[model samples]
Target: MTFPLIKHVRAFVVRGGGADYHDQGSGHWIDDHIATPMSRYPEYRQSRQSFGINVLGTLVVEIEAADGTVGFAVTTGGEPAAYIVEKHLARFLEGASVTDYEKIWDQMYFSTQFYGRKGLVVNALSGVDLALWDLLGKLRKEPVYQLLGGKVREELQFYATSSRPDLSKKLGFIGGKMPLHHGPAEGEEGLKKNIAELAEMRERVGDDFWLMLDCWMSLDLNYATRLAHEAHKHGLKWIEEALSPDDYWGYRDLKKNAPKGMLVTTGEHEATRWGFRMLLEMDCCDIIQPDVGWCGGITELIKISALADARGVMVIPHGSSVYSYHFVITRHNSPFAEFLMMAPDADKVVPMFNPLLLDEPVPVNGRLKLDDKPGFGVQLNPACKLHRPYTH
Candidate 1:
């Protein structure tokens, strides 16, 4: 019995929502109410759908072993990521062994140094890295968590990130993270409205249940500090991504000024260990949320989590579905999971990237049960309409 060699790499841009119903989702990732440096026109806020292009579709990556074993993962890289994988990255990985993940990851990271390092390049690299982990796990006949040093806990509790916290409470989730619709541009009145909304939710879910705000990198240092301070009275567990990931100073200020017992979390958009070093070293946030599909995959997350562990900070990978779920189960630092309420109504618990992944286990009563399935315990949906948006 010989180990299989990595013989093939493939990437695809697949979407949902319109017809085949894949990449079709919406959020406040880029709101006109938020005056980012890129777009500050006061009139831009007049048209609500102006910056909706921020929501790119999904990019799927696959690595096939010489023995015909196939491992795959998905992320939000779209066609640009597909181009990188099929054109540049495949050449470096085609002849490597399944166990050559670290070296291969380095080659991918350094080879794309000119145009890569952050944003979609790291995202593509993350997809490839994740596929490699799944490949290695399949080769070893073990779950990814087992390969990552076995499970630290038997099951994972989940907090729902959705607009309807009241419905989430009914679903038996531990907590509900509401997305903040207003930003600093909305003015002090917006701040009061945001806090009032939290107060409303607090009144609804009562004192025991956890209620947090996912500001989605829109609030400023003062606004975030104030939100945390005011919302703390209502028992807001944490304030997440209140400012941009690059705003280390803002994070520092927010953390310093936050109410005692309140937690600050960021890093959903931060990449690699070096980027995370700034976050940990600055003592920016209490929890670091690295998306496994974007933060250098499981390969880099292990390193990032190690950094967080040493600094006594929790590493909660963003809602990357099974990609994060597998890694979360392996570490003690990642005490709980964040489940993005992907159901159209945000009431039911469906697979995070519904229709894109087969066998992706969503949480059952806010807890996910992992069997001894090989790899990340997920398979790509054959029904998914994959499009190669570029030739490489």
Candidate 2:
């Protein structure tokens, strides 16, 4: 079968909550007192935004086929990422076969290898790669899952991430993950407060509901180990991203010393198959969490998943809304998905990427059944203004 060649590639930047989920306004739960690496500074400890976590607004990448079909994706990168897409990555897509994503990805990765093995460069590549897959699904007139492979499960079951696991339980979710408020910098009193919060939530939700802590890469080995041992008493399912993504040895030690039956998971910030290889080979954690938008998109994720699956490790992607859903439904290792409670109070379920995507799906009773629509089954909201930051 013949395919239309890629016609053009474009990049745009938008502010506020779209893909840069961190660029939220005041009082949003996501930015409220979450522990981070910068928490050691007294001035930056209260809010993540205070430390410039949301400096990168959102970047939108669009790829148009010669046949006039357009596929696009959003991720955290802003104007810098837009520049990478327009000035560097677009060259590999224009005039190539729409289905030549493998070659295009290789070109994009290696061409920028001097400065682009991970972080912002990989983020830009990921946005472009996902747009290509969306384009392929549209061209084939099938849902992205169908193109990847038929569904392994009928529907996806989700655990909520928020400040209120108690509220999430009332909403019918299977489990809840809360951010660890105080880090190593806060001393013994902060440690007691952290455990107190867990114990209180455990009592409210009762036992058997999964309760986990997201440390957000803010702890050292000693602190994470102590926290995990303490949290285990309250039936903590896992302690996530406790150490820096680069600290493989710390993760290995923490995983080993962690209370029996508890999981140690990380990888939201790690990118590419090579980075994941280190984690699996070193037996870093029980599960691996890769954000689809940040971990080299679907193409690289496939390779990363295979690595984890071989080692008997679970693959649970970080909250990326539809981008993660389409891929999760197709993998056996991906047993359940994550739904981040973006509601300001974490009281009601809201679209994870609200106001940016039209027809975005949300869980009903903590479960979601995907539709047959093609290309991730979403459209960019016309109401949100988008600025083209660069032109190729």
At residue 158, what lDDT does model 2 achieve?
95
By lDDT, the best candidate is: 2
Per-residue error (Å), model 1, residue 36: 7.9
Listed in order, each prediction's TM-score against the native is 0.93, 0.99
Assess candidate 1 and give its lDDT: 0.83
Deviation of model 1 at 99, angstroms: 0.4
lDDT of each: 0.83, 0.94
Off by over 4 Å in 1: 17-22, 25-49, 53-55
Query: Alpha-carbon error at 69 in model 1, in Å?
Result: 1.1
Query: What are the root-mean-square deviations of the candidates from the true structure over C-alphas?
Result: 2.8, 0.6
Candidate 1 residue-wise lDDT at 148: 92
Candidate 1 residue-pair clash tally: 7
